[model samples]
Each structure stands twice: as structure tokens, then as C-alpha cells.
Target chain A: MEIAQSLQQVKSSYIREILAAASDKNVISLAGGLPDEKTFPIDLMKPTLENLANMPEVFQYGSTAGYGPLLSFLNGYFQLPETHTAMITTGSQQGLDLIARAYVNPGDKVVMEAPSYLGAMQVFGLVQANIVTVSQTEFGPNLEELEQCFAEQKPKMFYAVPDFHNPTGVCWALETRQKVAELCIQYNVAFIEDAPYRELRFSGEALPLVSDFCPQNSIVLRSFSKIASPGLRIGVVTGKTSYLEPLIKIKQGADLHSSVPMQALLHGLLQHNNFATHITTICELYKSRYDVMYAELEKQLPASCVLKPVDGGMFVWVEIPECDTFELAKSLLANGVAVVPSPVFYPEGSAVKAALRLNFTNATPEELTVAVTRLADVLNAL
Target chain B: MEIAQSLQQVKSSYIREILAAASDKNVISLAGGLPDEKTFPIDLMKPTLENLANMPEVFQYGSTAGYGPLLSFLNGYFQLPETHTAMITTGSQQGLDLIARAYVNPGDKVVMEAPSYLGAMQVFGLVQANIVTVSQTEFGPNLEELEQCFAEQKPKMFYAVPDFHNPTGVCWALETRQKVAELCIQYNVAFIEDAPYRELRFSGEALPLVSDFCPQNSIVLRSFSKIASPGLRIGVVTGKTSYLEPLIKIKQGADLHSSVPMQALLHGLLQHNNFATHITTICELYKSRYDVMYAELEKQLPASCVLKPVDGGMFVWVEIPECDTFELAKSLLANGVAVVPSPVFYPEGSAVKAALRLNFTNATPEELTVAVTRLADVLNAL
Candidate 1:
């Protein structure tokens, strides 16, 4: 049978390709965006599981919005303005999918960062949205380019990871965040800010959220996958209720609701003070790992291959001069080290780039050292 | 903030309207299709939750396809044909949505039962599929009507619930089922068989599945929502590997994967011999409730209202001559009972109907008796 034209347009992610090659037992995979398992709050989760087992109500259907208690907890935690309503999602990915469905019309223009998250791009593609990309510059995403895109095409939505961006560990400057929010409101375009790594800061002060700058036009996607657990698939979409109401309705068609027991488990974790304490512990661990990976890269790699300054995110972006990262990635996989090529992050699949994204959170210091050494050897041979 | 044309085409399910009214303390709902919370396997679930507390791996990201052990268990249990591949879904609802994304294109023709599951209709609408309905006749969905539909329009797909269908509680005649399968294969149109209610039968011989007839083109959707716990949201999509491969990739973009802990919990529940015993207990309880409901309708409802014969399944579909079920549903809510009107299930929102779909599984026999009596009184007053 024939596949839908929309689905036919979606390109497979390079991360999956790299991971498939990393399946050999000896390969250390830094390609996929997975949270460290050891950081899971097992002790905090125990009481929640025990309580849920006895309360048979937890095994029944929940409202399409989410479990009431968890929703209430988030309402309090976020100190959400009256303008914004929040609903639990299966994950940030589902949040992106629902936003695509509720807002994106076929052939509608969507503005995204040049090297945006591939997962988000795939979802927008499946809805057949015409995506336009703006490059990330030293100050932030190119504002002149964004202004031109919005002014010329009046895109329906703008998707960004303003803080701790995936593939590239750069946070948008605060002024840039404020300007983007203002532009969205002026152009009558929705702004989507995905912050899976916002809470995982190892250095630097926290920046104001895009939603904070413009409550009515901005929507935020929050996930517990990094700070707490990924397997639970706990996340939320927060925005002005006017914007959020449509998504909640579409979410009903997506999966009815997220797992109720999982929501209750999230509630239990948040009820105690340990939730914040646990996040701090994870940040500390990731910081040390980041330091080790950075040290190794500086010692082994030539200065021509620039390694961007890392502050808070899980990944370190490296620009390798005169090389195709995709071809280089295959050789690195053969050498038992997995890394993601930069082209997957760009909207245009064949856009030229020689950058590699290496994750520092899922691997230990010893493993990072060995992986970097092997990567350097591969580059020298090339 | 203009909504997408695709989303604008979607209509909300009537169950939501009834549920909102049923929130009053005095109201008893026969509206939502929820399993009896009392019948959930709390005892069987306790040890699984306890075991999951220590297995920190449950809190980490899993493969996009599903948990391995659960996949293997289902593969063995289903004894799927060599041509078929299966993957776990967030719920049967997600399964429906993914199938729509994989197969339906904007303006593409889809054929469905006249009074099908509204949740499904909503998903197809979200994708802007041009849906046409064939009425369900006494023996099954009128096969003659379906064949004519296939012949005239060459619909891109046909969605059917052959056994113990929702709302109508009608099973297709053996010949009808075989003919539908043959037609789909002959026309090279995909056949989507939804079997959420298949395992909930209290009486009737098990019939052959559509997948058994046309393994290459038929995609079967299975759910554990009724047989086990809906809160876990475990379901599966089974089809030929060629067809399923694209869906698995799309599933990655949908939510990465279903909750890993929930899959682990489901795996634990299936390991014990009690899984079958527990299902039997649930069937018996629902059977008792169905009997009470069937009896109440016989005693109280006027001859003008016909309650379709229900051998098994949770609902009793009623057709009331000369009364609009939608308008009556409002008056019934005021009189302290809740039910879904039939128009929401039709492809066209304003299609005329005098039908109501009442769920008998969520309430006890005593509650059903009282609820049915109230329903009858409301109908008499109308």
C-alpha cells in the first residue's frame, strides 16, 4: 500500500542510524539523547508505587488533561500566571506532535532554528508544514533572518530550544529571547520553547523563559526525563489557556491521556523536597563528566577543529574542518565510539556541515576519555 | 490565532459532554467506556510495582519499538504469522492515531461504520480524511453497502470492528467478515480491524480474525484496557512487517516509546497463570451487570424503544423512535443519568439519529438497575 505523502516527507534521524551501528557490545553510544539511569530517584519512587498498587483507582482511566493532583502540583510549582494552563503530556515529543496537529495547516510556513532538534522537525514534516530555518549566531539565533522570514511569510509558528539547545550547547541570550517573544506576538505567530535540559545547568545563572516574556503567545514544553526519569515519559505543555485548550482537545485524539500511574508517581516525587535535591545531584555528576570530556578533547584534538565552550547542556558541539561528519561518524562507530552528525539537526537534509555532537551525560569519565581518544585517532587517519 | 483546517474538521466526542454533566454528586454515568475499577487486578499488580521500585532501569529510556520481554511474550502469545510484526502502543487510541498518520492523507477517502467509535472519528478528522459511513445492518455492517462504497470511490482504507463492536454490541456474520477481507485484498486497500472489545466477550464462540484471512493487508489493533488495567495504557498494533516498519518509525516521533515501567508491570501481570483466571473473573462480573441491564430495559422501556441484542461487550445500543437522542440526553442529565447520543459517532456531525449508547461495565448491577430505571422514566416523560 501507498504511504501518506506527509509521512513520506519525514526523514529518519541520524541518531538512530548511529545507535544501530553502536549495537555491538563494545561500542559506547553517545548518539542517542538518553538520561543517566543511575540518577533515578528509586527511593522516592518506592512509596508512590506501593501506594498506587493498593489504590485500584490508579489503574482506571484518567481525564484526557491529566491526573488532578499532578496538575495541581504543577500549577503551584510553576506559579503559572492566570493566562497559562498546563496539562501533562506523554513526553515533550508528544507535546510537539500535538502542537503540530492543532496549529500547523498543510503548506503553512513554520520558522525554526537552522540546527533544531531533529525529532521536532520530523513531526512538523509529518504534518507537511513548510519549514524555514534561521541560523544560530554568537549572540543567538539570527534575528535579521528571523525578521525577514516572519515579515515575508508570516509563519504560523516558531520552534526553539532557547536554553541548553540540543546538538549545540548554546543558550539564547536573554535579549534574544525577549525579542523573539515580541516578534511572535507582533506577527500573530505562536512561539514554542522546548526546555528538556533547562534544569540540568552545570554553570551559569538561569535565563528567563520565552513564555515568561510573552505569556499569551508563548508555549513551553517541560520534561522530567532529564532531571528525574525518561522511562516514565512525564512532561507537560504550558501556555495561555486559549492556546492550550485546542491542544488538550487534540491530545484526547492522540492517546486519551498519559499513563495515570506514572502521573501519580510524578506527583509523589514532587510532593517531597527530594525532587529538587535529586536534580542538584544529577547536575553535579554531569558537570564532572562534562569537564572530563572537555579536557580530553583539548588534549588530543588540533586547534583547527573548534570545540564550542560548554556551559550547561549534556552535549558538546565540535566543528571539524574539511570533513563530512556523517562519513566521519561511521568511522567513529567502527572504532567503538558513537556520535551524532550535525546535518540531522538541520531542516534541509543535505545541508553541508562538518560538526559532531558528543553527549557527555550518559557516559562516565573513563569512557569519555577513551571515546575522545578514539575520535581523535579517526580524525588523524582521515 | 487561526486553528488548522484539519483540526477545525474534528468534533468533540459526546462522551465528554455527558461526563461533564455526570460530575454532579447525584449523577450516575453510563457514558464513558471505562472498565470496572473494582475488577482491576490490585493483588496481582502489587508485587510488580514493588519489583519495579528497585529496577532503576525502568526509569530510563527504552527502545522506540517497546520493551523486549513484553514484545517476546506477546509474539509468542499471539502466534503471529511470519509476515506480521508487532509493537506496543501507548493505548489503542494512540494505535488509531498512528494508523491515521501512516495511511490517511488529506482529502483521501476512508470508509467507516455509520456509528463507529467517536474517538476514532476524531483522529481521522484531525488528519482531514474524507470519511464516508456505511450503516450497520442486522447481520453486520451492510457488506453490500461496503462493497458498493469500495467499488465507487475506491476508499484508501476500511476501518471495522468485527467482533463485539463498541456502542452497537454487534458482531459481524462470518460470511460478512470473510467478504470484507476478500474485498480489501482484491482492491489493494488496507483493512484496519480494531479488536478492543474482542477479549471481553462473556458468551459466543471465538471467530477467526481478519488478520487470519489477509495477513498482508490487515492491521489489527489490540488493547489490554478491558482485560487488565486501562491506567497502564498497554496496547499493540500487529500487521505485515512491511507495513509496520513505517509505523514504528512514526511511533518514535509520536512519544519515543510508551512508559517502560508500565510495560514492565504488564509483563509481570502476564507472567503468572492468574492472567487467564483474572480475565475470567472480569468477564463474569460484566456478564452479571449486563444481565441486570438487559432485564431492566425489558421491564421499564416502552415498546417504541428497541434495545439491540447484546451477547457480550460493555454497551447496549438503543434506538428510540421519534425522539432525538441528543436532545433527550440533556433532559436525562437533568433527571440524574448520563448517556452518549449517536450523532457524534456519525461521519457528518448533524446526521439525524434517535439512538443512544449506554455502557454497562463501569457500574455495578445494582447501580445499573437504578440507572436504567431512571433512563426509562426520562424517556417516558420525553
Candidate 2:
């Protein structure tokens, strides 16, 4: 059977290839956006795991919207307004895919930063959306360019990782969030707020979500993969009832619903008294690793290379002097350090930037230091 | 924002509405295809649930194909050829959905029996497939009509529930299965054999899967929902590696992978020594319920209402004198029993046979008796 034309255009993830290669025992891999396995709140989840046997209801088919108790808990936990609702997804990845399937027609315009989440690009690409990109500033998307694209393209939605942008790690400033929300409302565009790393803030004060300023005109996707467990594959999508209903309909066809036992386990973990402390612990641990990597890069990297300090999240973006970054990545991999090339994050055919996204979350402080030393040595030779 | 044009044509499940009404305390509902909650084998899963906390690797990200151990176990368990591979889906529903999204282009021809799975129709509808329906016989599909449709439309695939079919509960005759497989191979049409109810048989001897006749030309979907648990939402799809790779690509964007911890739990449960006994216990329980429902329908329904005894499956289709089944279902619900209308099963605007689908698995024998009496009373009045 011939594959769907829509699927033909989607390239298999390049990062997956790099991650596969980086898994060798000799490599100090930073190629994947994975959280450390050790930080999983398994102890906090023990009660739920033990109690699942007592809850016979979860073993039966559940509501397509979500496990009802989990949705109710999230409503109160997220402090959703009466007009808003929460629906659980297989993961936030499914949430994004549903949004695209529900709302994005082939050739429909979808805006995103050039350097954005690779997963988001893959989802939108599968739907055949005409992705429009705006350059990014330290604060957020370039407002002038964003406004021009919105006016010109009349895109259906603006997809973003506003908490700490993927590949770049730039959280949108308060003013930027408010302005982006205003633009979305003014242009009748939905703001798709993907907040997978929102709780990973280790240094700076948290800013309000872009959707907070335009609640009726936005959809928010929250992932548990970072703070809780990726293996559980549970995520939440919240928006006004009207915005979320179509996604629920699409989701019904997509997977019926996510796993009910996983939802119950997540609910139990969230309600635990120490869940907040658990998040803080992972954040601090990640911050220490990030500090070690950043300091090492500052000390050893060639003067031609430029790096930025990330307040939080998994990655630090380093701008290398212009060269063949893919070849550079291959050379670094052979030297026992793994990092992602920048091109994978951009829409296909977009201008390629010479950079690498270095993840600090999964590695130990010592590994992070050694990996940076290896990375700098390769760059100095180049 | 307006929904995608593809989604605009798809209807939200009418069975869902009937199911909502069915949940009333006073109603004896046969509206949902749910297994008996008592048969979930929580005891079999308990050991795994407790052990999940100790399996930290399961809490991290897993391969998109499936958890490694589960895939390995299924390989030997199913006796898959080296050329074939198995991938875990969120559910068998997801396997069907992935096949549609990965292969069916807009206006591409997809063939099914006139009265087929409602969820299958919805998934194909969402992809804008030009669905062609062949008439179904008690044994299986009308062979002449199926071949004619295949030759005329040249559909991308033929989707079916070969074992005990949904609603009708008509298990295909052994001869029909072999002929269908031959027809599929001759026409170069992919056979999508969805065998969710395959293992539910309590009396009949198990037959080889239709795929066994044309392994290279088929994709098989197997579900644990009927025998194990639905809330876990784990299903397996197996086919030639070439046929399944597209599905895996679609699944990565659908949800990175299904819940890995759920995958691990399912793996452990499948490996337990008592798991075979657990399946036998549920089969016996469901068989008892089916017998009660079948007897009650035979004793209570008017002669004008036709009933066929089923060897296994959750439902029994009752054909009534030509009338509006939707209205009949509403009346039955008003009389404190709920069932699915026949029109919802057929493709929209097709000539629908006046019938009702009554589930026997979830309800008790007493409720089955009461529900049938109510159903008879209403039909006799009509």
C-alpha cells in the first residue's frame, strides 16, 4: 500500500539517530532531551502503584477525555476557570498532534520560532502545515517580524515552548508573553503554549504563561515527563471548553484515551505532600550539572565560540563559528561527547545556524565537565 | 479556529451519547463493549504493579516500537517470522488509526462490510477515505460482493474483524477466512485483520488467523481489552517490517510511545504462570453471560425479532422488522435498557438494516434478563 502523501513529507527524527549512536558505553551522551532516570519520583509513586490493585474501576475502559478523577484533580490543581477544562493525552506529544489534526488543514499556516522544539516541527509537518518562522531574540520571538508574519500569513496558530524554548533555552520575558498573547487575540490566532519544562526553573522567578493573558484564545499543553516520569507517558491539555472539545474528538479517534492506571498514578503522585519537594530536588540537581558544564565551556572553548547562560531547562545553546556542523557533530561523537546539531530543530529548508544544543539534565556533573572538555577540544581543532 | 475539513465530515460517536444515558443507576445497559470488571485479573497484575517502582528504567523514555522485553516476549509467543515485527499501540483502536493515517490518503478507497465497527468508520472518515462497503453474510462478507468491490474500487486495504465481529458476533467460517486471504493476495490488497475478539471463544475450536494464509500481504491487530483489561490501553500490531515501519513513524508523532510503565506491567502480567488460567476464567464467565442473554432473547422477544446465537464476543445483533432503530433505541433507553442503534454502525446514508447491538459481557445475568424483558416489552408494543 502506498503511504499517505502527508506522511511522505515527514522525515524520521535525526536526533533519534544521534541518540542511538550516543548510547554506546564510551559516549557521554547529550544528544537526547531525556530527563535523568534516577530523578523519577518512584518513591512518591509507590503508594499509587500498590493501591492500583484495589481500584478495579481503572481496569475498565475510561472516558475518552481522561480518567475523570485525574481531570477533576487537575482542574483544582491548575485552578482552571469554569469555562476551561482539562483533558489527558498519551503525552503532550499527542496533545500537539491532536491539535494539528483537529485544526490544521494542509497548507494552513502555523508560526513558530526558527529554532524551536523538533517534536513540534515533526507534528506540524505530518499535518502538512505551511510553517512560518520568526527569528528569536534573547527575550522571545522578534515582535516586529512576528507581527508582520501574523498580518501577512493569517496563520491558524503560533506554536511555542515559551517556558524555556527548546534548543535555545530562552524563556519569554513577561512583556513578550503579554504582547504575544495580545497579537494572538488581535489576529484571531490560537497560541499553543507547550510547557513541558515550566517547572524546571532553578534560578529565575517564573513568568505567567502567554495563555494566561489570552485564556479564551489559547491552548496549553503540560507534560509530566520532566518532573515525574516519561515512561508513564501522561500529559495534560487545557483550554476553554470550546477549544478543547475538538481535540477530545480527535483524540477519541487517535487513541481512545491515555492509560487510566498511569493517570491514576500521576494523580496520586501529584497529591503527595512531597511532590513539590521532589520537583525542587530534580531542579537543583540539574542546575548543579548545568553549572559545571557552563563553567567548563567558559574555561576551555575557543574564543570564536559564543555561549549563553540558561536560567533553567535541559539545554544550553552554543553558537559555534560557521562551519559544517553535522560533520563537526560526527567528529565530536567519535571523541566520546554527544550533542545535537542545530539544523534538526529548524523547519526543513530554513536557514541553518551553526550551533549545538548541549543537554545538562541527564548527565552527572563529572560527565558534563568531561563532555564539555571533549567538545571544546574538537572545536579548537576545527 | 475552524476545524480541519477532514474532521468536519466525521461525526462524534452517537454511541457515546447512548452510553452516557446508559450509565444511569436505573438502566440496564448493553450499550458499551466493556468487559466484566470482575474478570480483570487484578491479582495477576498486582505483582507487576508493586515491582514497577523498582524498575526505574521503565520510568524513563523507552523505544517507540515498545518496551524491549515485551517485544521480545511477543516475538516468541506469537511465533512471528523474522521478516515480521510487532509494535505496541496505545490500543488496537490506535493501531487502526495509525494504519489509516499512515496509508489512507484523502479519497483513497477503503473497503469494509456495510455494518462494521463504528470506530473503524470514524478513523477512516477522519482521513477522508472513500469507504466502500460490501454486504456481510452470517458466515463473513459476501465473497462475490467483496471481490467485485475489490476489482472495481481497488481499495488500499480491506479491514475486518474476522473472529467474532463487533455487534453481529459473526465469527467467519474457516473456508471464508481462507478465501478472503486468497482474494487479498490475488488483488494485492492489504488485509487488516483486527482480532480483538479472537481469544473470547468459550466453546468453538480456535482456528488459524486469516493472516496465516497470507502473512506477507497482511497486518494483524490483536487486543487485550476483551480478555485482560481495557484501561491499560495496550494493543499489539504485527506485520512485515516494511508495512509496519510507516506506522511506527506515525506513532512517534502520535505519542512518543505508549505508556512504558504500562508496557512493563503488561509484560510482567503476560509472563505470570497463572495468566493462561486467568484467560480461561474470563472466557468461562463471559460465556455464562452470553448464554443467559441469548436464552432471554429467545424466550422473551417477539417472533418478528431475529436473534442468532454467538459462540463468543461481547455483543449479539438483534434484527427487527424494518423500522427506525434510533427511535427504537431511545424507547428502549426510556424503558430502562440501553442499546446501540444499527444506523450508527453502517456508513452514513447507507441502507441500514433495522437492528440493535446488545452487549452481554459487562452486565450480570439478572440484568441481562431484566434488560431483555424491557426490550421485548417495547418492541412488542411497537
Candidate 3:
């Protein structure tokens, strides 16, 4: 039972550790990025799933490319460029894994935000990429630092979450989006834009997609995990055919294809309801939950412990002055609250000190209020 | 974009190319190993899928390990050793991919049959494993050659298909299965037993599983794709916790988890029906089709062209005495039939000459008769 050298490079995810620790049933978990299950379209899904099981195609093997109807739907929905192609993945996580395999050689340079999606970082690490970090400002990755890494590191891939980034929940400004895309083109790098939370916006106007800015080299990863159903595990990666051919080749050996019944179910849902209406309905439900948690945290937490309000997405980033968030998280877990510390999302030596990410979607208004008060008390004591 | 060095090693799958070429709507493809859709449990699934969709848990994110109920079902079904554990995969293909990542380091030696599953070979290629091939005799891999390779190559893993092997419909003898397990222990190697078609047996006494012989290092992969439904993409990998731990760690970055709705649907099916009765029904259906094709080929083909009789499995391996099967396959496709040539299944230097693999599972008895008649005509002419 010898392990591969690459396995040594991967660490068990901190989120998994936190979630397991949160399973005491007494802990209020703000650790995972799960969308509230109550908001799932159970009423709408009954007929859709019934229709899917009757179709013989749902019981047969699908093309490695994807389930055809969903492929057509995604191609139209994403408004992919004529030269670009779209392939359905098991989820956005598989999309990242495919991209990493397509472009990364062991020790190849890759770039990411200081606090990015932890899952993406794990994929890059498993591939043994030489990861470089760029610091983030409120708007996006710091343009100056990004340019320096692109110039010096010459990374093979630059992974970004331009819209409603995980952990940070910060949407990139329109100018920053364009600049990041341009930097990839100039540096001859693949821009891996993960946009799972793009449709979860509660208030702010949508910015241009990084793919929209540079369609040639930029690859976009989208998921139905948040907006539709995570448990069904449907997602897609879109890019120019030249880059996608390698990803598809690697994907053939990965999982063959995603589950066809899941794809057919999503296709049926799209046919039955307007996609925009579905997004808006879920947004309204999560918006109020976000508001309650933000308002209570603002009232209870000291000014030194800042809770940054997000316009959209699941997480609210908090900065605790002169406190280690990891130690604080352990203490808070003992006090019946759970939050994700910031270190797991960073490249070593570049982690933000005293930062934590709190998820607002899963908790009810009352549960969120109580959880934040407990969190605030722990922060104030520190 | 610069493709990863690993991608250079991956030749595009011959099955994929054959299937793509067969999509012209004229060719009757005996190339892919797709189960007959007519046997799919649509009546049983209709209510089950509907019920699953209404459960909020089916639409939310699942545990990375698996859906709990299904995990419990498999853990019991396999009757795993006390030291062993099991985890769900998107498909058995994913199970193979995870095993490759968990054990293969660059240029590590791995053993496989000369004519093995093409997809597994592709996974080994993606990881750049030093694949050592052992020639197969009528029953299984040549014992003497296998022992020589294990001793000399000192391979990290020995990948075997002890039951209903792909491309070549050969099952290992009881003694051969035990010998493989004993050698792996003797050489400190992992034995990867892929059992996708194990349950599809229409006749012949069951041999003990390789895992039953050596639980310490054997990782067994099982799938519902052949027996239940391919579109659901449910599969499992079982092994001692020592081997499973790395696989679980690697699986986290792969796809997070298998689709919960699909797992629940399968779980519901198992709960609703006698599993043995379901297996018997599908096996009877495919066995009739297999008989039709084998009878037709035996009657029409020349003496030099031999069709091997399989006890039970989807594929029938044919050896063409003096003709190139690749060229024969191309000519047959022109005559409205498609078959997979043996070269794709072999190691670089050891391809079995003038052979082809024909799948009997997907087609009807009528279709299989026509397909073999056309194939026999081409073989006789050659």
C-alpha cells in the first residue's frame, strides 16, 4: 500500500476537518459553502425527474463529451464564441481537475489569489504545480502584484474567481476583470475563471465575464451546484477548442462522463422554467438570510473585528485584528460555533493573518443571529 | 497553449474514434460495451426518481466519501474484511483513475495483461507508469511470464480482470486468481481487480474474488453500469484502509463525490427488488443475443477465422489467421459494420495479430445476427 509521491503533496482539506468537527449537532456551522437545502426546487423537480426516468437515454451510457441536450442548452446559455466548445463535467471540481491535467506539468508555474477557493488549490497541488500567489485588494487581485508574477513566474495557468469568489466573496471590478484577462493573453497563460457563484448575486450589477474580455485563452468553469442542484453534480467548462481538446482527452480517462440522469433532469428543469426566474427566486431566499447575519454581526462585533458585507455569494470575510483565526476557530467550535480560517486558501507564506470566512446561506435568520453573537463574543474576548 | 507532457503519452482512445466514426448512422457498431437499454429498470425507477427529487438531501451537496445509505449498502454487500473500507466513485472508470493517482509515480513499473482494457491502459499512460505486459493464455495471463515480470520488474501494482475481462472475454481460473493475490503479497504490490462485468455471468461457477484471497493490498473495483444502469454512473472501490486513505484523499480533488440522486435511485432499486432476480433477468437477455452472434459467426466464417466461445461476458474475441484486423475493420465499416481491432488493447510491442473484439450486449438478437454475418463475410474474404 505504497502511496504516490504526488499524494504527499496533498493535505486533507481543512473544510472537511471543520465539517467533521461541526457534526456534533450542537455546533452552528458556518464552515462549508453549501447552499441552503430548503431553497432547493423540490416542487419543480418532482415532474422533471419523473419525465427523465421514462426516457431510455437516461439509463444508457452518455458520450464522453456530455449528455447532448444539456450540451446544447449550455452552449446556448453560455453564449460561447463560435470557435469555443463546451463540455459538461461531473462538477466544477472535475472541471478544475481536468484543466490542471491538460496544462500543468509537475513543477509548472501556476498563479492564484492569496485567498482563493481551497478546492482549486488542492487540485493544483495534487498536480504538483509550482504555485505563486498574488495579493487581493477589495476590487480583485492586485494588478501590480499580478503583473509581477506573470512577468517573473510565467505561469502556465492563472486561476481566478472573478464573480463571487469563495472564501472572500468579492466580485472583481469590470476593469480588473479585463486587466486580468489581458495579462493572461500577454503572458501566454491560460486564465482559469471559476464562476460557480456568478448567478447568486443579491444586489450588485453583473460585471463582464473574464471570458468575455479574452475569449481566446480564457477558459470558464460554471456549475449548477449552487444555482440548481449540487447533489446532482452537473457543471461545464468552456474554452476555445484548441485548449479544450486536451482537457477532453484527459477527461476521457478521468470519469468517461457525468451521470446522464442528472443532466437530463437539469435539462427538463430548464425546459419547464425560465432560467432567469429560477435564479431570481433562489437569490431572494438567500438574500434575507445574508442580511440578518450581517446586521447582527455589525451590531455585536467590535470595530477592530471587521465583518465585510458581500453584495452576493455565500461567504462574508471577517478580519480579526491581532488574533489567529485558526486558533479562534477551534475556540469557537468549543463555544458551539464553526467558521473556516483563512490559511487553507493561501499559498504558504502569503496567508492573510487573523482572517475567517463565515457562510450565511445554510443557517436560518434566528440561528444565524445566535451564531454571530457567539462568534462576536469570542472575537471580543480575544 | 502548451499541453502537459503527460498528454503526449495518451493516444486518443480507439473505442472513442470507432464510436465517433460509427455515428454516421449507417454502421452497426459492435465496438462499444454498452448494456442494452431495453433491460433498464424504467418501471422500478419511475417512482424512485420521483421520490428522490422531492428529498432535499438529494439536491444538496453530499459527503465526499459517498451517500451514507449507499455506502452502508455496499459495505454490507461486499462483506468486506474488518481491515477494509469502501468508497463510491462516479464510475468504475473514475475508480481506475483514482487508483492510478494513489499508487503510480512517474515511471513506476505496473503490470497488466497484454490484451487489457484500453481505458485502464490510458489511465496508466496519463501517469507515465512503466507498464509491463504479461501475455494471456486461454485461461488467464501466462503464469510463468507473470511471475517473471513480477520478480524482475518489481511492479508497484498488478492490474487484473479476473472475471469477464474487457476486449478479451477471458476469465481467470480459480488457481490463477489465488496465484495473482499470493504474488502481489510476495512482491509487495497492489492488486487492482476490476470487476465491472463479474455479475453479468450467464453461466459458469463463480471463482473467489482476488480481494478475498489477499485483503491487505488488493483494491477491488465494482460497477452497476453493466448490471443496473450505465447512465447513473455508480461504482465502488474497496480495499484495506491503508490503500483506501490515499484514494479518498485523491478523490476529494477529483469530483468531491458521486451524484446523490443517482445513488439514491440505485439504493431505492436495491431496496425494492431482489438483486439476484434482476441480475438473472438481464443475463438471460444478453446471453440469447450472444448465442445468436456466436452461432452465426461459426456457421459463416472460414476455418482460419476463429471465434472464441465465452462462458459469459459481453465480448467475443476473434482471431483472424493471416489478415490485418485493423484493415479488415475499416473494410467492414464500409460494409455497414464496426468492430474494435486488438492492437489498441495490447502493449506497444506485444499486440495479438489479426484479432478483433465484438460486443454482443448492446445489440438485439436480430442486429447481432446481421452484424456477425457481415463480419464473417469480411473475415472469409480476407
**Over the stretch B1-382, how does candidate 2's per-residue lDDT look in tens digits?**
8999999998889988988998899999999999989889899999999988889999999899999999999999899999999999999999999999999999998899879999999999999998999888999999999998888888899999988898799999999999999999999999999999999998888989999999999999999998889999999999999999999999999998999888888898899999999988888999998999999999999999889888888889999999978888889899999999898999876788999999999889999999999999999999
DockQ scores of the candidates: 0.83, 0.92, 0.86
Q: Residue-wise lDDT of candidate 1 within A1-382, one digit each (tens)? A: 7888888877776677777778787998778777788888988888888889767877999888899989988998989987777898998889998898888888988888878888888888888899888888755689988988899998988998888888788888889988988888888888889999999888888888987878888889999999888999989998888888888889999899999999999999988778789888989999999999999999998777888776787888888887767778888888999999887888874355678889999888999999999999998787
TM-score (C-alpha) between model 3 and the true structure: 0.98
- DockQ-wise, the better of 2 and 3 is 2
Give the alpha carbon lDDT tens digit for every residue of A1-382 in model 3.
6689998878898899899999888999999899988777766666777677569977898888788888888788778778989998899899999999888989998898888888988898888998888888889999999999899888888898988788898889888988888988898888888999999999979788987888998899988888888998988889998988988898889989889988888887776656668789889988999999989988999899766778899999987786666888899999999999878888766756668899998889988999999998888887
Native-referenced Cα lDDT, model 3: 0.86
Candidate 1 residue-wise lDDT at A136: 86
Q: Give TM-scores of chain A for all candidates.
A: 0.97, 0.99, 0.97
Q: Looking at candidate 2, what is the lDDT of residue A313?
A: 91
| TM of chain B, each | 0.97, 0.99, 0.97
Output the lDDT of residue B275, model 1: 85
Candidate 3 Cα deviation (angstroms), residue A314 = 0.8
**Model 2 Cα shift for residue B297 (angstroms):** 1.0
Candidate 3: deviation at residue B173, Å? 1.0
Q: Model 1, range B39-153, lDDT digits (tens) per residue?
A: 8887887788888978888789888888998988888888987777789899988999889988888889888888888888888888889888888886678888888989998
B212-291, model 3: which lDDT tens digit per residue? 88888789999989888889988899988788888889889999998998889888887765667878999999889888
